[model samples]
Target chain A: MSETGDGSLSPARPSRGMFGVSGSSDTSGFNGLATPVHADLSTPKPYGSWYDEATDHLAEVFGGFGDAIERIVVDRGELTLHVKREHILELCRTMRDDPSLRFELLSSVSGVDYIDSPRRLHAVYHLTSMTYRRRLRLEVATTVEDPHIPSVVSVYPTADWHEREAWDFFGIVFDGHPALTRIQMPDDWIGHPQRKDYPLGGIDVEYKGAHVPPPDERRSYA
Target chain B: MTTTDTPGTGASPTDPFAPSRDTTEGRIFTLVGGDWDSLTDEAISGTEKMVVNMGPQHPSTHGVLRLVLELEGETVTECRLVIGYLHTGIEKSTEYRNWVQGVTFVTRMDYLAPLYNETAYCLAVEKLLGITDDIPERATVIRVLVMELQRIASHLVWLATGGLELGAMGMMLYGWREREVILEILELITGLRMNHAYVRPGGVIQDLPPGAVDKIREFLVYMPKKIKENEGLLAGNPIWAARNKNVGVIDASGCVALGVTGPLLRAAGLPWDLRKQEPYCGYETYEFDVPTRENGDCWARFEVRVAEMRESLKIIEQCLGKLRPGPVMIGDKKIAWPAQLALGSDGMGNSLDHIRNIMGTSMEALIHHFKLVTEGFRVPAGQVYVPIESPRGEMGYHVVSDGGTRPYRVHVRDPSFVNLQAVPAMTEGSMISDVIAAVASVDPVMGGVDR
Candidate 1:
């Protein structure tokens, strides 16, 4: 363990940086002092099993596979294609319609905000191909400043609610969505609650006005 | 504004029964008084397309689902669903807690199928930790046992609620009775009747207690007869048949397009059961059938669910046969919490003897315990999506970690959330009454939907 900026020891391998509420309130002294922890666990060529074949087919069908896809990660025996935001819809349509990659069912669409990265907002899509009995994930990254990713509701109608949910939680705008309204949160609710910067809206546990502070800010007997 | 056809055209400005002349969307009627005559007159004259709001609170809409229906004389032209009335932000809360604490939060999502939610979330965590292979065989068996039991319970609830909504109240009683049998067995095994956070990241919170296996076996014998009785109460009844058959007709293609799964998709005849197709938790070793039906309607869903309960019984029986005496939690000391726990007169608490031994000799053991409970074991930084076949459908957890004790993000692809999208597709062309049957067939728990 090496000393951090505040003269506190910070462990080097497999960092435990983000401990408390992510912004200035973080007193756990674990906030990332390292350079870029998640640089996309990019797997190399011959990415074992079906991953290599899938990428080959994607490259064959969609021109500029290198340009559209930023990296191909095969971690935990799952394939994640980190694609550019502009090509998300194009990639999804090809994935759905192409004979080689008929990922007909759009299983889920989720979002993650990596606050440290320049392209902080990531829209993650999980697609399943019932025919091939295979699963593939597509991720699209965008800057928080311009968090716009093309909608894939045209190709997979199921993505409509999923996209709206991503918009509701992460504030990632899905361009050309039928009705991009707040889904899980109220329409009048103000900022995205799931982003890294958003304060976890919490209250103290209370009974008859006697309360214990929220867990993170509580005193510890360590 | 469709001002061409306005009932209560010349009423007092302050009249309680006066129908406000609004735009083409539809007019708003301020009927504080019971003006039945005026209401009928207004309904007959005030535009052919009448917009009726069913509920954020209606009984038959299956949990806080609001349907905005555009009806043209009993025929629904358009049906739109308004959900999000039950959002608890469980996903956001998981990011704040340690990895093990996440079970309590996730188990509350799909309340009826709580074990499935926990198993799915835990499986994803295990996969992320790369300890999937290290999990003990007994734990895998118990996980499967509890999950299949939850499947039966959840399907029984669907049967109960679906029957009650369609007017067969007797069937509802029978369905819930059988479900109670399973829930009792579950309460004995896990600690609660519902939302049991029994399944943990490494393994189950505890192993099956004494007589739990016998009780499950007893349920295996009892439920098949109960399912048959339930089928007898509804399958032949003319009103029940008429109310259900061809009511919520969503074809296989429709199911695929709308991302609907579980029994609804199986009833549509694709047989896309994740338990069979994507077998996790050693489900491949267990013998069970994926029941399917061709009608793709409420009756078809009813048939599929009943058949599935019998299959769950089969799997539960297999699980009982497979249970071997061994450790339930993993053996790795650093990963496992409280290394040893004792049951019986001690009332299922951590072993005091083990604690004493560790405290007297090993400072490292105390530190390991302290770090584990306080700040969970660090997972390698990456993301993983693990989907399991929940009673509603494919319930998945998309978990991302920044190599930390707490998860970076945990997003649930709740099947209830996805299948609720098919409400419009099923109910739009059908009559106003059929909307209830359509939604009941979908069987969405709003807790999962709005979570």
Candidate 2:
């Protein structure tokens, strides 16, 4: 920690901003101060509260729990299980069927695009267990080149629309989905609009000889 | 729009058959070559079913929602909900703006329960900032009060529109009439009626206005009588009962499997309200019941919603008695908005006193104010999902911050969007008219559904 002239202590870390952009052309002088990032993602056991107990039960039921799970993160009183992309279907079945860990309801499914990271596209699923009254987040990260994850629609029928939405926004294909059509965007939309690299607006205008490049070819604060 | 940019037989807008969506069994569309007899025979031969397209634009849809129904005579064989007509990309838009500016976008998501959107967003942001407990008691009480008031207003709209669709003309006008009072009270407190972005990250935007507590207290007395009158109007009427009873039924297991929530889930006798179960924003301390019904039908949802409005009035009364005077926003200067607004002689609200003090007395305060306002405070990089019991259901905000002034991503789990999935389960094998009652019971606001 560094003590400022006013005797206030601040952390020492790499800086990137106005809006978390690094080495950008849109330099408005908010790129100097270091901000704290909660990077210690993997929480050590004995994870407190119902989280540890839940994880223990999930491990007991699923034979390949260690292989299926990439990491376990607990932050802000929520449990997030980073699951491998290939095992999502099997893991969801275990979560839903096991008596001790009956996560019957898949509350939501969303996606995130971390542009500079190696495994950039993340498909996130929020599962709710009415039997245990618990919530768990299952995250599956994959690269932009290969953005395929198993669909949980068979286990949780509610995943039908949510999976389609994730595919519509971020282009993370949920393999084995019954009919994975666009849910939120028009079917003719050319590119995923929610990726970090996608322009906020003003990229494509359908006029003759209109030259417009997509996925952030304009001046952007991103 | 590009799908119909040009008109021709090949580019015909009527033949919107996308192969990706054509997974139904034995479904085919053969364009008739002006042969009325053959067309009639083909449609009635059981090899082809009559398909009805109701609304991306009809009155019964409540908003812009389209349903494609394949029918056998009067019974619906298949019901498919085609949404996304009202997608505004609010989730993608929030990634580009600062945290304080996010509330404006989120409140427009579930327009009926706008306060719930604001509160859930603020609570998630607060959780990311690690200042959840630092929120003052007065602010929490005000948030609970305003949200419950929003609940009543939202349910009133539900009743109004649902009644209008089901042939109860008087209930439509009466339900909307009662909602205007709640909107007026909201306008008096938050300076706007519909999309009031009053709840901020650290706390609420400002303290309750003068006589706001008394107005809410007055509403607490007035609303119960209106709720009772509504029940009396619809509860015993034979037409209402026939139109609603046992229509559009989905039991508890089906509700949970489809992720249906709010009054619909409670109407299935689950009583799984997040307010009573998870208890955020001092809701655990409030004395209220989670109303439930035995049958999972349209009429049961109506009964549950009516009882819920009474419970909301009870909570609002408790909030009136629990109101205390304190700073509504947080005390931290770096995090709080650098202004204390007051009405000026020019008939505008501005932080004149704060401006004068910063300009004249403290040069440091001036610098702090400029820095804080222009480049907002940084939040620690993390993701959090905060869920609240909205009038419709479990409205959740899954917010991710990258330690910047702006959010990395903001995903809203609108109950309307999730609950609309249950329409097929409710409407299939039922009469065509029950589709209206089913959609109304689901209450999927297209703004929320397509956001």
Candidate 3:
């Protein structure tokens, strides 16, 4: 829920002579003019300086592992960490129990297929720490050939269905899941349909007389 | 109020693992399947238990969710939840559509927080393309305003349904009344009520309409008072307190361990709001507070959402006040089309580019336009993950692009799906009625879950 960069995020200047407030420190205008009715509530802090110490501390603890962390971008108010596959579960476990990095909540687990990239698949974890008032992301890249990642269901019970979904759609196998059944798609359905290479509308063998047109051949409403 | 009953009397006799039988392995040798049915029937009838299906279509489920409940009188012995009644396969279909067209498809999935879905997808695409900063200010403001509005709308539905579950019929009516105003605003801006494809790549579909600002202002002024009135209606009521207070309790440790977020996490006495901690969409600019409660009960979640609506109102007001003039879309003409093209006027090829393409270059403009619309833009070969705080919790997109027009992998981390897991832990030893209260408190929207 990061606010887009509008001037509203920064703390408003008080009105008058008192720091940034108006005339009498009660209602006086910033200048000599009449008092304004309302106060601007938006508060802005220097972005980099605000979270620098805490983030730096975590980075220090991460030490050599920091090099494998590809992207550490903040957007729309979330701090996302793009870690390679080998370190994802360890990072999650550390983030969960570490005093400073108490990301106890494993909020979500899902898979994304980067079919075009050298490492073709990604498992994304969203974690929140109630104690630290922070949120962190962990990402791992794997290829389609061996799309396997350790399951976090042992840590977070909610990972059960989420892992099943990733397996059902993208075909990313959670190695230690209790039951990786198709939660959405029928259990017998073939192919990981959500994979980019999977056809949008496959040949309807039941309707052998007709051909299902590809996406572009259909009518355009726009 | 304590009822002490024997724990394992109902275990099957002929099955040997049945509780009615002795624990030793020697007891198993004495029993066989032939007389087991009669023995189990007699033991079960004496013990008293029943099995009931709550829904693939029950009102308390809030959507098409089926819960199989094994109950011993008023207490639940075991519960199994069944889902997937509304699987549209939007993720599968996304591979077939172009990148831009995927916005409309993803927006329809959650239904409650459409903008969050659109933003996550756009961020992933931008990451893959290495064009994160191409989004313009106006588009950003529109995105913030709409997303906040969606959050408000989503919380309203949660409040409405939560109230209905508590037997407070008036709350649902009033909650929905406020929600319709937000929907009207969405329709006015995006042309659709629930799923608005207004937030697209590079920028939004179009700019806000004239008079949209004033309407939002009026709604902002009117909403807080209505919120207070609704709060008064339920906040101090005796039955409401009794039904909600200690029922379905989950502490902060359990919440964090289970991956819960949004109000549910806040209600557990944590200030882990994505807006405050992560600061997406300029939420840092808005003057508002993240409401939190320590009880971690059904009532606490209800209180958090009620307070969140007020904070959201403050945000909407700030956005409207600062609604300055600027272009909504970014990037050169190569990526996004110029905003001035008329529909029918292009039919006769009256434009210069049309003439150049038709007479000189063999309809190259038409071909490029066709390809752009048909195949969509190809993204670089990479992966990007983006997360947003929707009303449910952390809504995120994990995108993988293979240098193709369609996304190679697009997965949504829907909050409802994550939050639903908290149900079993919350309901384990509770009475059957409290199970309803517990679920309503967590506020799982099955649309997001089943997706």
Candidate 4:
């Protein structure tokens, strides 16, 4: 339960590195700025036109899985269902098979590392229902120690490469993936490069009598 | 001794084909170890399979794309696509820069359709700022115009490369010749032929230059005739028809299952276009049709792309009619760029009048410019995903901001990446020669795929 500058419990610990180097000068000028970490968001009922009906239907259909549904968030005119990690597979199957919630096309599967939260890794799935002309987002989060989520390839075969990509960049393990090798990086490369703590590996540039520091080494206003 | 007495026979362990070689380097090995008659009989029996790698560096792959194929004779038994040779890590680099600088990074991802990338990213930023409605009418119209024009250019590249792959070299020449006209128009407006970071957050970088409209009108009159001639060359040719018809077929169900969209999905008989279904950037007002085909093969994709170019022409004509003179950028000085940009001797820069005002007389204008340029305006803490139809398919940007000048995380769901997943399914059982047609039909720009 380490606390950040704002006194909120953050899972992310301050690294010994300065902008990714083990020991370097801290050139980022952030004394006057405050980094705003987002708290969990929730919306009130009657959440616009199609949102209310969709949530009500989801709740009615998955009545048996109590507390598996953590929360339903409607923000920026989009609906998101934050489900527990264990029940994500069942939820995806139900969402894909249900006639009312036929999200037939899995548009994207992306991973976001929220290093400040208890569940440090988040897997976001964007599902598109061409039949109903609607879109839904399903998210599941897990910690670094136990970053395992069931593969939804059985339900959406398109998740094969996407799951591999997520695993490649975020170090989130998808259990039962056929071949979970790196898709974007070299197979022998070490460390997930997209993590918040991972340093942006940029080198200083020397060009035409001018010297420019790398992005991480440059002054930061955040 | 009698068997080894053949001419050039030397029973060398290092050279397996010692008996057949006339020169030292001419060691030609055969699959059959013992007798040619037995190997020929076995080959005729159809039980041999070989593995071959097509490219990460061959022509006709459209870019640096590698395909590994398992062939039984000439027919392919299995196909595997190996991408990531062109990985630029643009998304990871975007995290370190501010929001305003992100446009330059994203516009390079799908190099064929740079406007779609900028529009999607800007729309997401505006959504996070809750200023979707505040964008000026002229800006939106210009966005629609440039995006449609980009679509035409992208489809023409697809046509040109696809034609070259299928041995229709004349079509390749015609397609590029027609596409050059559009690129000149783009350069006239945006000042770059490719990777034009013209579309900024609040609006475009600058209003359209003079005579740009007349040039577009000239293009509108000239492009249709060229498209007709190009189609006439390939649409009825027996060789082209035989090469494309029923090759690499994926039906509507398969397309949905594999998350394929755009011309690939439309060619599969589903008219699920994001512009028509979701209607971003006031696309609903523009009258056009979503061209579709029932065949869902390489030929269908080719036909759909050509028809789509025609439809884009219609949209561009409407945009020409809808053009009105007004402010392009938003009035809000806080979020909008402070300087009005103009083409200078070196490159594009702030206009002389604004620079003079800030430098000489107006201290307030100087401070405003300094603050806006140094630290960009902050967006509210939230996450949003905005999808727009590019020439390839649905291009989406999932932007997360933590109420800072820089983005927390940004992930681009590029259509080229998603549609490339269907290559294995489409080319698994097809002939080895058909792989070129299938990959070209996908029209994957590897910049978008590997980014």
TM-score of each: 0.88, 0.89, 0.74, 0.89
lDDT of each: 0.84, 0.84, 0.72, 0.84
RMSD of each: 7.3, 7.6, 15.8, 6.7
| Pick by lDDT: 2 or 3, better one | 2
Model 2 misses residue B295 by how many Å?
0.8
lDDT of 3 by residue, B1-451 (tens): 1112243443344444332334654332232446667757865776855688998778999888777788876788787777788888887777656688888889887888888889878867765555667778778888889988888888888878888988999889999998999999998888788777778777787778778888888888888888898889889798888989988889887876777778898999988777888776677888889899999998888899989988888888888876789888775443564333222444422356554554576565554455455445555434455677888888878775544456655778888887787888888778999999998887887777776
True contacts kept of each: 0.51, 0.49, 0.36, 0.43
* Alpha-carbon DockQ of candidate 3: 0.15
In model 2, how large is the Cα lDDT of residue B300? Answer: 95
Q: Which CAPRI tier for candidate 2?
A: acceptable
Provide the DockQ value for model 4.
0.30
**Model 3 bad stretches (over 4 Å):** A1-92, A98-103, A113-149, A171-173, A188-191, A203-222, B1-49, B337-371
Q: A26-145, model 3: which lDDT tens digit per residue?
A: 221112322111122322333353245555666677655666566554433445566766666666666666688777766667676655457666677777566665656676778888
Candidate 3, residue B139: Cα displacement in angstroms equals 1.9
lDDT of 2 by residue, B1-451 (tens): 2233332323343443422112354333444345566767877886668899999999999889999999988899999999999999999988877788899999999999899999999999988887898988888999998999999999999999999898888878998999999999999989899999899888888888888888887888888888988889889899889989999999999988899999999999999999988899998898999999999999999999999998988899899888877889988776777777787887546678888999999997887687666667677666888989998898889998766777889999999999999999999999999999889888888989998
What DockQ was computed for model 1?
0.33
- Native-interface RMSD of candidate 1: 6.2
**Per-prediction DockQ, in order?**
0.33, 0.34, 0.15, 0.30
lDDT for each residue of candidate 4 in A26-70, tens digit (9 for 90 to 100)? 223133242536456455566776887887888789764558877
| Deviation from native of the Cα of residue B161 in model 4, angstroms | 0.4
